[model samples]
Target: MTGIEAINVYCGLARLPVPALFAGRGLDPARLDHLMMTERSVGLPCEDPVSNAVNAARPVVDALSPEERDSIELLVTSSESGIDYSKSIASYVHAYLGLGRNCRVMEVKQACYAATGVLQLAAGYLASGVSPGARALVIATDVSMADARAGYAEPATGHGAAALLIGPDARVLELDPGAFGLYSYETLDSARPEPDRDIADVDASLFAYLDCLSRSFADYRSRVADADWHTTFTRLALHTPFAGLVKAGHRKLTRELTGAGPDAVAADFAERVAPSLHYPSRVGNLCSGSVYLALCSLIDHLPPGAPPQRIGLFSYGSGCASEFFSGLVGEGARQALAPARIGERLAARVPIGFDEYTDLLAGNSRCLLPVADRDIDLAPYERFLTADPGRGRLLVHRGTKNYHRTYEWV
Candidate 1:
C-alpha cells in the first residue's frame, strides 16, 4: 500500500500568451523557420515559455502550504535540459522553493516519455505500500532546442512545466496498478542534443515522429488484445508533438481498434478532443510536459456532475521510446482543479515584439548583466540572488522556481 494511493494533476500551462508579443513581433510565417535572425537565440517570448511553465504550476503549489512541499518523499524532475549535468533540477527546484533536504531528488531520461515513466514508477512504490503515508512530487518542463538553425527551430518551441502532487486520497484518481503499459525502442538516430552538443538533423521531422507514435499504438494494442483485455478506452490525453499529432494517431488507432469502420467510439473521441488543443497551439511542444498539459486542459473543460472518465495516454520520446497508459479521472477532479482561475492567467499575457523577443533571448542567464530585486508576483515563493559569479564558480542563480515566478494567489 503506497503512502498516497492516487494521482490528481494540478494546473498545466501551455504557452506564454504574449498577445502583445505576437501582435508586435510577428512570428516567422514560414511553416518552420530555421536560422534565427535574432542577435541571440534567446528571446523574451522564449523566456515566457519557461516562465509560463513555472507560472502555470504556481497555483497548485500555493494550494499546499510550505509544510506540504517540505514533506514530499521524492521530487522527480523529468526534462531534456538540466542547468548542468552535474546539478540536479530537482535539487535546484527544491532549494528555490525551500523544500526540505529530506526530499529524494532524481531526474528521468527517456525523451518526451520520461515524465510518464516517472509517474508510473512513483505509483508502483505507492502501490507496494512502501511509503504508506508519503507523497511524490513530479514536475516536467522543457525549453526550446538551443540551436536557432534547425527545421524544428521556430520560436514555435515554447517553454513550460506541469506539476502534479501525487498522494493518497479517495477523492482523486485511484491508482490503477496493473492498467498502464510500458514500452521502448533504443537508438540515437533521432536524439535531442546533449548539453555539449547542438540540434541534430531532423532525419525524422515532427510528422515522422507522429508516424512512429501511430506504429507504437498499433504494436501495444496487439499486446492488450493478446492478454484478453477487451476493455474500451474512451478519451485520451495525448503528448502534443507540433499539434494535432494526437488526432492523427487517434485516427489510425481507432481504425485498427474498430476494424476500419466508422463507429461511435472513434467519432466521439475525435469530436470531444477539440478542447485539448487549446494550450498546445499556443505553447508549442513542451517535450515532456505535453501529456500532462493535455490532461489538465481536458480537466478544465469537463462538465460538472460528469461521470468518471477513462483516458488513454500515448507518450513518445525520440531516440525512440514510447508507452501507453490508462487512468480514470476521479469524481472529485473538479474542485481539486480550480480550473477557471488558471484560464484567466493564461489569457492575461502581453505579447512581445520579435525584436524584444530577440533581446530577451540574447540576455538569458546573463552573468554580467545587473538584476534588481524585482517582484515576480506570479510565482508562489521567494527568489533571491544567492551568489556573485566572481567566486571562481560558473555563475548560477537559484530559487524555489515552481510553475511561475511568484505568487498572486492572494
Candidate 2:
C-alpha cells in the first residue's frame, strides 16, 4: 500500500531549441530527425541542484496538511551534480522544505538510476510498518555539464529535477508487491570524473540501455506469474535520455517479447510509449529523474476521468544500474497532480536562442565546482528571474562563501 502520493518537476524558466543548439555546435541538422527532441531546458547560473530540488518539491510539500508534512520521515536527494564532496544536497532541500528534523536524510549516486533505487528502498521501509504512516520525499535533481564536448548528447542533456512524495496513501501510483527486476555491472559508458566536465561513450551507453531494458524485463517476468510484455501493462515508461532512445528500447523489447512486425510495433509504440515521451521531447533528459518525467508525461496524457490503469516502468542509470517495475495509477492520479501545473509552467518557459545558450554554458559549468568563494551575477539573468511565477517560493543559489553554498528564495 505504499507508492508515490504526488509528483512534480522544476524545469527552469528557459528553454533552447534543439535545432538552435545543433546549429550552434555545427552538428548535422539531419540528426534532429533521429533525436526526437525539439527543445532542452536551460539552467540559469543562479540555479543549482539544491535549488532545483527545493523548487520542485515545495509545491508538493506545501500542499500537504501540517500533519502529513510532519509525517515525512525520510528525504533522499539523488544527483550527479554535487557541489561539495562531503555534503549532500538533501541537507539544503530538507532545510528549505522545512521537513521534520527527525526525518532520515541522505543522498545517493548511480547516475540516472539513483532515484528509482532509493524509491524502492523507501517503499519497503514504509510497507514494513515499523514506522506506520511514515512518508519519504525523493528528489532527483541535476544540472547539465553538457557543452560542445558532449557532442549530440549536449543537446539532449537537460537541466531540472523531479520530486516525489511516497507514502501509504499512494494516490498517484501504487507499487505492485514483489514485482521487479534488477541489473547492475561496471562499465564506463558515462562519468563525471571531475567537476564541470562530462565524458560519455554514446554508443556504449545506448547499447547498455537497450541491453538492460531487455534483461531487466526478463528477470521481472521470471519473478512474476503470467507476465507478458505485450499484455501485462497498458502503458510503459522507459528512461528517456532522448525520445529516440526510448523508441529504440521499446522496439527492442517489443520485438523480443511479442515478435510483432514493424507495423504492429509502430502502432503499439504510438499508443503506449509515445505519450511518455512528450516531456522528454520538450525538456530533454533529466538524468536520474528522466524516467519519472516520462511517467508524469504518461499520467498527464490520460484523458480526464479515465479509469485506473497499470503502468510498466524501466529506469537505467549509466554506471549501469537498472530496474523494471510495475505500479498502479489510481483513477484520481491526474487530478491529484494537477496543482503542480507542470505543463503550463513548461510552456511558460522563455525561449532562448543559440547565442544566449552559448553564453550560459560558462556560468552553468561552475555550478558543481568546489570553489571557496564566488558571487553569481544574476544581473545578467534578470529576465529569467524577474517574471518567475513561483517567485517567493522558488529557491535559488546565490553563490558560495568560504566554500559554503548559499541560497535564497527568488
Candidate 3:
C-alpha cells in the first residue's frame, strides 16, 4: 500500500482578479459572474514553470533530514512546460533541490494527465520491493497560457505546482494497489505547438472530458464490483478546468451511479466535493497540478476528529486520458497538511491590474535570448525573464548557434 507521506504546493506570486481581467475585454461581467462567480483569479506571468516547480518542491525537501533526503530514489516531474527539448526538467529540479545524485530522474507528458500517470508509476516502484525503505519525489508543475484568440479559456488559465513525497508510511491518503481504472484515446481537443500559445476546440474538449469521465468511472465500478460507490466514498477530487465543470462532472456522476435528480446531486456535491474546490476557485486552472491541488484542498478543509475518509480522484488530460482511483485517508491526514499555512501563502500574493497583465504576457520571451543583442533589458519586458547575477539560480538558453543551455549557481 504505497501512499503519500508529505505534500506541498506553490501558486504563482502574481495574480489578476477575474473582474479586472475581463473589464474591458467585451465580456459581459454579469454573465461571467453568474458562470464563474467573483472569487476567481488567474496566475500572472511572474515566474517560469521551472521556478514554480523548484519553489514548490523546496519545502518538502527542507522538511526532510539530510539522511531522508539521501533516501530519495526517484525524482519524476510531469509538465507540459518543459524548458528544453533534450533535457528533462527533473534534472534541473534535482540540481535545484540538491537531491541525492544516485536518484533516477525523468519527465513525463501526456497533456495534463502526466502527473497522475507518473504518480501511479512511482507508487508501483515503491511497492515492487526494489528499495525497501526508499522514497520517490513526484512533481506536477504547469503555467497555463492562452493566446488572445483563446477567448473563454484565457480567463480560465492558471499556473502553479504541487510536489508529493511518496512512501509506505501513508500519513496522508493510502492508495489501494489494485483499485484503479484508466481510459485513453487520440483526439485534437487541445494543443500547444508554440511555446507560449495554447489553443483548444472548446465544445469538442468539453464533450471529450465528460465522455472520459463516464468511461473511467464505469471501469472503476467494474473493477471494485462489491463496493457501494455512492455511500462508500465520502469525498471526490475531480480535475478542474473551471469550477462549474467540476460541479457538472459531479452531477453527471451522481446521475449515472444512483439515478439521482438534480436536487440530490447538488446536495451530494455540496457535502462531498465543494470543500475541495477552494484552490481551484481561487487559482483557475493548474494544468497538471489541478487534481492534486484539489486533494490538498480536501485534506486541508476536513473537520476536526472527522472519521477516516475514502476519497475518489478523477484525473483528465487533454490529448485525452482519464483515470479514476480511490484512497483511504488516515487520522493523521489533517495534521499532516496544515491548511492554514497554505492559506497564508495564497493570501500573500500581489495582485496586478489587467494592463500590467497584458504587458507581461506580451513581453514573455520564453527564455529565448535575442540572437543579435545580448545586452537587451528584459526587466521591463518580463521580470521573470531577466537574469539576475546575484540570485543563485539562473537558466540561459543560447540559440541554435551554440545549441547549449547553461545552469549557473553563484
Q: What TM-score, computed on C-alpha atoms, does each candidate reach?
A: 0.73, 0.98, 0.90
What C-alpha lDDT does candidate 3 achieve relative to the native structure? Answer: 0.76
Give the candidate number with the greatest TM-score: 2
How much is the lDDT of residue 58 in candidate 2?
93
* Alpha-carbon shift of residue 257 in model 1 (angstroms): 2.8
Candidate order by lDDT, highest to lowest? 2, 3, 1
For every candidate in turn, the CA RMSD to the true structure comes to 8.2, 1.0, 3.9
Candidates' C-alpha lDDT: 0.53, 0.92, 0.76
lDDT of 1 at 95: 50
Report clashes for each candidate as comma-separated counts. 36, 1, 0
Off by over 4 Å in 3: 30-46, 365-410
lDDT of 2 at 126: 91
In the range 40-149, model 1's lDDT, one tens digit per residue, is: 11222213222333343444555566766555788888877555445556655665444678768877767778887888788777557766666777778655544345
Per-residue CA lDDT of model 3 for 53-159, tens digit only, reads: 87778878888899899989899999888767777878878988899998999998888788888888899989998899899999998776674688777777777
Query: Which is the better candidate, 1 or 3, if ranked by lDDT?
Result: 3
Candidate with maximal lDDT: 2
**Shift of residue 29 alpha carbon in model 1, Å:** 5.7
